[model samples]
Target: MESAIRITRETEFYQGYIRFKMAVTNESPYAVNEVTLDFVYDDELLRVDRYEPLYVEKKGKLHLGSIDGGKSKSIAVYFDPQMCSKGTDIECNVAYKDYKGKRYIVQMEPKEISVICPIFRTVSDINTGRLKEILERLPHSESCVFEVLSSFDMFKLVNLSREVIEKRNVKHVRTLYTKDKTNYELWYYGKTKVNDDNIVIKLSFLAVQHTVELFAATQTAEALTGLLADVGKDLKVTIESRVTGKGRFNLHLINSKITGNTINNLLDQCNMDGTCDVNIVIDNINERTNAGRSSVNNTNFLNEQEEQRLEAEKQALIKIEQEKQESLQKEKAEKELLRKREEERLRKQREELGRIQAAEEPKRKEEEYARLKKEKERQEQLQKEKAEKELLRQREEEWLKKQKEKLEQIKTAEEAKIKQNEAQARLRMEQEMQERLQKEKAKQELLHKREKEKAEKQLKNKNASTCQKINSNNSKSNNKMLMFVVVFGILVLIVFFAIIPAASSSEQKAIDESVKGDNYYNQGNYDSALQAYDNAIELDVDNSTYYHSKGTALCGLGRYDESLDSYNKALDLDENYTAAWTGKGYALNELSRYDEALVAFDKAIEINSMDAQAWSGKSEALFKLGKYEEAQAAAEDALDVRSFG
Candidate 1:
């Protein structure tokens, strides 16, 4: 039956498995049904593991169901590299039925499958003669070999070997060390299952050298070789032993008689140690002896043959001499007759040539003269065109010169205009700066006047309050006349006679200076307030109020440490000074001495429990100390006291 299907097969090697993909297209007019594909490969070299659509073990077949006309179907088969022997081919057979239930089977030509062991790929990459020799010596049918560079360490080589094996799906890898511990062995299965065939790889390290040797009993030598080569490339080292047969001589039998002794001598010359099969053509001893006798007799028979050969040569020379004499007589007769005929023909041709030349001479001269006249007119026209071109060139040069001059003048004008604009801009900027400065100066003067008036008003209020307190004290003294009249009369006589004038003079002046400092402090003039407070303290050094006022001015100036010292002095004069204690806490807080600040705040609270500022300062110190709970309580206390006030 005629075939109506086209099939294409492809094979690829990935890790240890060979993948076969077949694309089948139906070219018939009717749809094909029950399409099944069968893959046949050498069982010893390859074993089918799985396939697409449907996979049947042992049979290596896949059922593709059906395919429509002009449609295609693909099937893939994955198989393990069993032996990986060279020169092996894999066959594919496709069987299917058409819509009429007519069965047809197509057997495609066997495709040559190359199971390139990774090791062989690596050997190819190195392309070294030494490596190729080593690869040829390796048993390609059942074994593989690998050698690490002289610079590689054995420990790293072993680790890299395991990685290479694992990547190829080899499992249960275990290392074994030799008795001397100088050599190691790795045993693993070709597949993930333990029951599968195992590959035994022996590794040995060369002493006093940097090279490592690896030997394995497996069919996937190519895979191992490629892995080692890749590692060598990554390490920038060279692999010394890669087995290849590229340059080696491969013996083949030809149609020639070779004796056993000759074969032995040839083998000896090659120094071959391996077993080799030599095909020999057996012959009978009697037949060989008769042929030798026949060769000797034929030599004598050749002498007789030479005499007959000389006799034939003599006869041929005699015949050639007779023919030469006859040819010379015929040639002389023919030459005499041809010479007479040639002379007659030449005489007639010469007379005809003279007549033709005499007639054409005048016509030739007339054509020559006309040609010369046209040449003179052409030269004259060219001279006229050259003169006009020269005149046009001169005019163009003059026009360009005028254009250049105008462009230069315009450029100069633009540059001058830019300079004038820049000068005007600079002058306007200077005027604006002057105006801003004048406005700032006026604002400062107005601020100074307002501050002075505010300070004066505060000072007047302070003086009035002081006068009221003094009057209150005098009224109290008057009210206590009945109860301490005798004591008061005695004290009044002592103050009037011994202390009244001196106390009034020095203490009154100190109070006035203290008031002046208070005014300055209220006006936000801490530097002047500090100086005025210093004067008051000089006049009355024992006055705790004077020191307290000075500490306030110091705190306003951000001199927390100096402020603390002044507050301390105030406390020394009067330990119960609440304002001084609170100011000292604020100064300590500013100095980042949170613990000392808390203690000062506690003291102020003890002296005057209603002091809200002291409570707030204590809360701030607590917050700084990371005591969130205590800080919250203190803050609440501050709010309560503030609300009460």
Candidate 2:
């Protein structure tokens, strides 16, 4: 029921190795079949080699298995310090499980682990057999979890199940999985172990890209190494390893060229569009049965793409069908118009016959008696027929007029539709062009910025190199000038002493003391220099130079308290001594007395406003006191002064 693993012996070796020891006591009635240890370290430099007796799978994974409860086991593994970049620390964790499938941490220990320092000169400078030796002698601890992931890659720790009667016969472990931004998925089975009470398994998956943390809940290195190898065959990189400890001390190195990035990218590629199912199983040694849990889902990228493609195809089909419909409607409208015109012609002929018949019928009736009566009746019949024909003609004419109107409306509608389609197409084209141009402009701007940065870095390096050369030359010139001055002074002193009355002994002694102090200070003998300066000040307390010299020496000796007092004395003697104020500020700042340091720097700035050092000191003091904005302002002020000066 306890959360953390207990440490029997957790220590780091000097040879860049870690050793962990733990007691696997089985408190339950069920026997512990197996124990697994998972070791993790930060191996950035890849200083560990393949042939160093370290067990690493081809995919940069290691697995160690077979630890029993009520039994104590020790694991030792080496880490290559050369593989670690400067400032990176190494750490590890241990996991324990019982045969009855109950899981818990080892009873006694701290979770936090410290990294051991390596022999820097041998690996960084010498570099010969260094990796092998270091790997063999790595110090490890069972107290905490050691996580040794190299880069962000797609990997999964899977617990494989062998179907058995009992549900408790499942392994416990954690696997890493990763997918790239593009969403591609990969699957790999690492390694697994079945022991008396506990089962440890490792599985590698090639989907979901992320930086995963290694925890104690993970299985042994042996299982993980095998799983990585399975995944590595299809991937650009893989991790393989051999297990040591209850999977605690992983003396395993990676045999993988697959960078974390490559794995992640592949995962992204896989997940970009599809359904993926990742299954994990837990097994218990006592029951010989394992239970499995599966997670399956469709990637959002896939669903989105499918939806987009479907929408696009649907729109295209609709557009094509609409065009066909419009064509059919146009042809039908033309046929209706032609039929209307033919009907109109027939109607005109019918109206003419009706007029002729009516006129003839009235004349025939007056001419003949019996013959006239018969002829008149026939004429009346003809007139009736003509009237009927005239009515049909008018109906035909009305139908023709309606058909003409419909034809005109169709023509207008077709033209308007065509115009609207053209306008929309034109707008889409213009928008696309604008977007392309904007993208091009952005790319150009990015290129320009990168070029500017490169040019600036080059210029800075050139200036730094030039300044170093100039400084070297100046030092040589100064030495030559000093030699010449010393020689000339000796000659002048001999002539003056011989020609004039000798100076008083006190004046001579004072001058001698000042000369000695200057010599000692120049030679970096700060204590001696300070003593000599004290003597000089005793002889002439008003001498500001003596106080300044003493303050400079005290500062060099790390006597900031004494140095601040001396600088203040020098300032009292000469209020305009800018150098003394600078020294005092520096000393006070060293003592973390920022307020006083600020005041001293401010005074120096007032005396000589263009002094960059005084302004810089003020900035530093402000920064230390958590006044970042003020610090920035002060720094800017110093830069302005330096730039202008």
lDDT on C-alpha atoms for all candidate structures:
0.56, 0.47
C-alpha TM-scores of all predictions: 0.29, 0.23
Tens-place lDDT per residue, model 2, 1-645, is: 343233454444321222333333444444443345444343432233222233334334333344433444444444333221223323333444455343432323333333321111111111113312221232221111112343332211221111110112232221112323322221211112232111112223322332221111112332222222222221111122211233321112233232211222222222222222353221122122224534333332335565476456445544654685577467546644764584466456545654664576466445446676888999999999999999999997886555445333432443234334433543564466457656755765675576557556655755665566555777768656755765575576457544432333444455557668767876879889889989988877887867877887898899999898898899899989887887788789889999999999999989988776777778778877878678767767765775675
TM-score winner = 1
**What TM-score would you give candidate 1 relative to the actual structure?**
0.29
Cα distance off (Å), candidate 2, residue 245: 75
